[model samples]
Target: MTEATNDTTSPVRPLRDALTFLLIVSATFGLQLLTLVTGIIMARLLGVEGRGVIALVLAVSVFAAQLSFGGCLPPAITKLLAERGANARDGLGHVFRRRGWLLLLPCLVAGGLMLVLLDDGAAGQRFEIAVIAVVVTLQTLFFSIIGGAMQGEGRLVRMAWVALTPQGLFTIALAVVAALDWGWSATDVLLAYIATGVLSVLVAMASLLPAERGDDVGAERRVPEASLWSEARGNYVSGVRPLDGLGLERILVGGLLGTTALGLFATGLAVSNLCRLVSNAVSVVVLPRVAAHQGDPAQQRAVVRRWFTISLVLVGGIVAVLELLVEPVIRLAFGEEFVGAVSVARWLIVADGLLALRRVLIAALQGQGRGGVASWVELALLPVLVVGIALSALRESLDGVGMSLAAVGLLSCLALGRAVFRAPSARHRGRATSCTQQRRW
Candidate 1:
């Protein structure tokens, strides 16, 4: 029997990993449910207008964070770990210590600029929104770095706890505070988010401390500096490439359709975000598996295909359900003023399904170390998105506008799917060629 078969038959390792994956998924889903309840409470307590304001601020914060972080966290961490699993334990500490300051510099400058440029009135009573954004960005960077360390070591259970607890607790706390009328203004809400972010970082840091004391048992050899730079750049490019077009498209929509229309659009996006809980759960499991098997072509392809199929089926089913119950869901979550949001949500159910497919395809690319190609694909689609959003916003009817925007999502899915299918088959071919070359050598 093969060595791998013998190892598999040993029983302990697979069981442990499977149990860990199950635990992480269960805890994550629980947290997601709590978060959903929190959102519902916030909508009920704040009313449509208030919730709209909160949504606007959040959108801006998330946009700023993406730009500041360069959207590099996931692939960077996963790649680094996969490439230098053991050495990563040592090198990452140095990388974080030195790079932390450099990363924070851009975020600080951007946050300051945003504070100066955005109308203070838009921030409303959440005047401290800018500060909260800064804090959240810093915390996110630190958390990502630490989480990367845990992932690199394959300690996913620890990583999940470090990554999710603060978010779960913060959502629960905010809902409770808001419900009780316990000094919960918009600013207070922002503060809670910032606080949660800080706590997450702290927990992640704590998780990493033990690794410092333990031996680097599985650390891979250090990658070359040039290779490391190339990988990092490629990953950053790939991750943010989609944002270039997508961000511009949103901007165009807001400018052409006005804030009220944007607000309505935002609600649809938020409803769609609920669907992501499933995608995230799957990703949390799939990503590290892909990374660990980077050398195995057949396994990699099989995993990618399986994940894509499963994600599409699951997301599609959820969207269908949401489509059927759109009106009642809106009434229960956001009250009557947001009745329009129901139709928007129904349309977005389709959009989010498309988005989930795109996400899974991109994850596969990242796993295969083709982040640069993925980035290019996103860049290619930007203009189409921008133009689509602009045209949609110009429509006279609000419902027409929503439909137009949703169409852009459908278009994106088609374009992205084509690109993913067409990606270089070189990785698979290389495996065969390498075996022949090794025999000759």
Candidate 2:
């Protein structure tokens, strides 16, 4: 009698995927919590005005870091790995190993330019800020590249661990130092960040090295040098433009409203953007899958739809809660002096909910190789952001400015949401016809 063939399907549940998602979400949430705690401690230690300065510096660093990286590497690596699978590891390594330095060159130049452009009352503090900016930019770029590569290789669990561990340790260390009555200067925090950044990079590189070793998959198809360069260029260009828009908006706000006001606005925005962590965690998982299924329109659409629905429902629920409890949250997390931030934080929640939904749509576009379109969309919206920020900055009162900015948030959300919904869908008959026509070429 013929023995029944064993079902060789791996018995392991999609626990790996679930764990990967959880790890990133946990890491993001932990980082936010640590920062919140650190911020609280720093406020108590440094008083309101000093805390405001720290927040300002952090805002500048965050804007610089995001603009410097251009949000390209993560999606680029994810797409390449998804399309090429395990056989693409060496090529992926080659891209990262070679272009990594080139990616950093811009950050150094931009950071220096920003520092030079700013009016510095004291040379020592200016120099310190410059150092912090450089360190922060480097830290951001390294973490993004390493994290992206790991996610592309489908080892997101390791990537998430690498991403979180250093930040977690640094946060804990900072809290200890603050509790012990160590001076809470900008230099001290910058040093802590640098130390953590170095540690995280080391861990991520070590974790990814093995996966970067190409497996014996019986001779894979060679990716052309030109094609790889073209892909990288496309990703870089597409990614940088939106980030530029965002950066420009922040810079204008900082310049027009003074650092203190910028500090308040930025803090509120950061807290609100924390909700996007949920969508981001999901995107890391969804990006690779979407890329893998790009050739199959039906499958791609199904995946995108599923993730989008889940994101909207989750983010919407969280925003509702945040809107209700924003006052208590702000007072508890950032101290009573920041009680004025409650309204701004609520507005940000509304904006972030819209942004979260837009992210899912953008991810789908990126996965489908519509980077150019995504880039154009961002460029188009730059004017809207600029106008909103300018009008808000012109206000004399903080509450008035906050309300005007909230109006901006509402407008931006509506515009972004419209763009997302109007984006080309797989189910569109016209798109299907276009796909068929393109296939003939």
lDDT (CA) per prediction: 0.58, 0.61
Could you give candidate 1's per-residue lDDT for residues 303-365 as a string of tens digits? 777867878787878888878777786677757767777776676677667666666666666
- RMSD per model, one decimal: 5.1, 5.9
lDDT of 2 by residue, 89-110 (tens): 4645555555667766755654
TM-score of 1: 0.79
> What lDDT would candidate 2 get against the real structure?
0.61
What is the TM-score of each predicted model, taking all chains together? Answer: 0.79, 0.79
- Locate the minimum summed-lDDT window of 10 residues in model 1: 1-10
In model 2, the Cα lDDT at residue 347 comes to 73
